[model samples]
Each structure stands twice: as structure tokens, then as C-alpha cells.
Target: MVLILIAMQFYSPTKNISPGNHTQIFIKETNPSPNLKALFETSCYDCHSNNTVYPWYNNIAPISYWIDSHVKDRKKNLNFSVWQNYSLDKKDHLLDEIEKMVVQAEMPLTEYTYLHGNSKITDKEVVEIIAWVKQTRIIYQLGKQPK
Candidate 1:
């Protein structure tokens, strides 16, 4: 059993960190205010960004797998790290989805906040994020050329 446990350490999932330019974050193109960037980085970047600053314990097994699964699931749902890949229409749609998710307190998955208390989005941060999303979506919508 000890050997099995030791070997399991080698099975840790790939870390999500990256050194590439943040071409994926579409909102960056809009030149978000500095405050907005800070808010997003603090409250949303861990699981949403391409570069995750993994915790030390993330090197452990089982726990690493679980964390990886959550990250993968979230990235599939809304990868802010790959935001630029989305079309304007898609961006607007995603913004709408974000607003709904924030309003309902479904974001920053509970399990995540249990460890990284800072990951929890406060009401003020929620309001700010939603407002920014709405503003950006309006820009995307208005910029759409007539079909």
C-alpha cells in the first residue's frame, strides 16, 4: 500500500500554467481599467486563466486529479484564458452568461474557496464584474455590422 501511494504521486495531472502571451483574454483587447484587471485576477483567474498559480498541495495525488477535473470543466464552460478566440457574438453571449452565473452565486466553485479564501468574490466584486461584462457586451453588439 505504501508503494502504491508513493507511485500515485507520479500520476499528478498536468499543471495549467503557461508562459505564452495572454492572447486568449479577449477583454484585454478592450483595454479594461486597471481596477477591473485586479478584480478579475483576484476573483476569477485561477481556474479561468491559462496561467494558474497552483497551490503547493496541488502536487499531491487524488487531490491534483480532482483539481484538474474542476479546472477542465470550468475552462470548457468559460475559458477566459481563451477569450480572444471567441467571435463578437459569442463574447456577448458569454458575458450574458457570466452575469447570470455571478448573480446566482454559482461561480468560484465552493470547493475552491474552501482552500483559497481569497477566491471568493465579494458582493462588490460581483457587481463590478457584472457591470463590466454588460458594458463590453454592449460594445460588441453595437459593433456588429448589419447583415
Candidate 2:
């Protein structure tokens, strides 16, 4: 078992790092307030966006694999890094989902918060996120997508 664990450390999934402002488009379109944007950078972007600020444990064996899978699944659900690819309707729906998840405290996952103490969103932050989502959805609903 020791040998197997050691061997697992030899391999790791590719890191998810992108150059420049990968989420600029998403920010331009959604326009989250400064505080809300900071919340996303610290609490949410790691998994939900293409850029991830990997933790030290990520250098370990199975933990690295686990984080990779978790990030992949989250990106599949909503990759703010690729937000421009989503249609207006899809963006609206995703924003709706974001509101639901945050309000229910299902986001930034409990296990994630354990390791990332600061990632835990306060009730006030959740309320702010919900408000931001509501405001952003208005742009999509009105078909006022900026080019």
C-alpha cells in the first residue's frame, strides 16, 4: 500500500492555468460589484473557472487527482472562464442556478471550505451574490447582450 501510494505521486493531471484575464468576458457581461468580484476570486473561481489557485496539498497523490476531477466537473457545470461561449438563455439559467446554490449554501462545497478557510461565504455574501445574479439576469432577459 505504501508503494502504491508512492507510485501514485508520480503522475498528476494537467494543471488548469490560463494566461491573461481569462474571465474578463464574464466580468464584462455580468459586471459583479467589486466586493462580489473579490468573493468570486477568493471563494469560487478556483473550481468554477479555468484558472485555479492550487493548494499545497494539490502536489500530493490522490488529492491532486481528486481536485482535478472536482474542478473539471465544476467547470463543466459553469466555467466562467468560458462564459462567452454560453448563449444568453444559458447564461440566464446558469445565473439562476448560481443564486439557488449560494442561497442554499451548496456552493464553495463544504469539503472545499474545510481546506480553504477563507472560501467560506458568509450569509451576507450569499445575499450579495443572489442580488448580483438577479441584476445580471436582467441583461440576459432583455437580450441586451453587449458585444
Candidate 3:
């Protein structure tokens, strides 16, 4: 078992790193305030975006695989890196879901916060995100989003 674990360390899962600003388009379209953008980067981007700031533990075997799986599932659900590719309606829907998850404290998953305590969003921040979501959706509703 020990040798197998040691061997596993040699084959870490492929990381989700993107060159340049993977979220540049998304940031341009959504127009989050500086504070909100910081919130998303610190709290929401690790798993939900193409670039993840992997922790040191991720160098280990099963933990790397587990973290990779979460990133895959989250990006599939709502990859901010590809926000530009989504239709306006999809953007609105995802914004709603983002508000709901944050409001319910279901995001920045506890398992994630357990390791990344600084990434946890507080209730006050949730309120701020909710407001930001409502305000941002209006741009989509107006049908004059940025190109």
C-alpha cells in the first residue's frame, strides 16, 4: 500500500491551468465591481474557472484526482472562463443560480473552505453578490451586452 501510494504521486492529474487571462471576456461582459471581482477570484474561481490555484496538498495522489473531478464538474455547470460562449439567456440563468448558491451558503463548498478558509464568502459578501447578480442580469435583459 505504501509503495502504491508513493507511485501514485508520480502520476498527478492534469492541472486546469490556462495561459493568459482565461476570464478576460467574462470580466468584460459581466462588469463586476472591483470588490466583486476580487470576491469571485478569491472565493469562486478556483474550481469554477479554467485556472485553479492548486494547494500544496494537490501534489499528492487521490487528493489531486478528487480536486480535478470537482473542477471538471463545476466548470461543466458554470465555467466563468467560457462565459463569453454562453447565450444571454444562459448567462442570466447562471447568474440566478450563482446568487441562489451563495445566498444558501452552498458554494465555496465546505470541503473547499476546510482547506482554503480565506476563500469562504461571508453572509455580508453573499448579500453583496446577490445585489451584483441582480444588477448584472439587467445588462443581459437589455440585450446589448459587450462583444
Most lDDT-accurate candidate:
2
* Stretches > 4 Å off in candidate 1: 1-3, 23-25
For candidate 3, write residues 41-73 as lDDT tens digits: 988889889999989989989888898998999
Descending-TM-score candidate ranking: 2, 3, 1
Cand. 2 TM to true fold: 0.94
lDDT of 2 by residue, 93-129 (tens): 9999999998888988999899889889998988889
lDDT of each: 0.78, 0.91, 0.90
What does the lDDT read for residue 125 in candidate 2? 89
Flag the better candidate by lDDT, 2 or 3: 2
Q: Weakest 10 consecutive residues, lDDT, candidate 1? A: 22-31
lDDT of 1 at 125: 77
- For model 3, the superposed segments whose C-alpha errors exceed 4 Å read 144-147
Cα misplacement distance, residue 5 of candidate 1 (Å):
3.1
lDDT of 2: 0.91
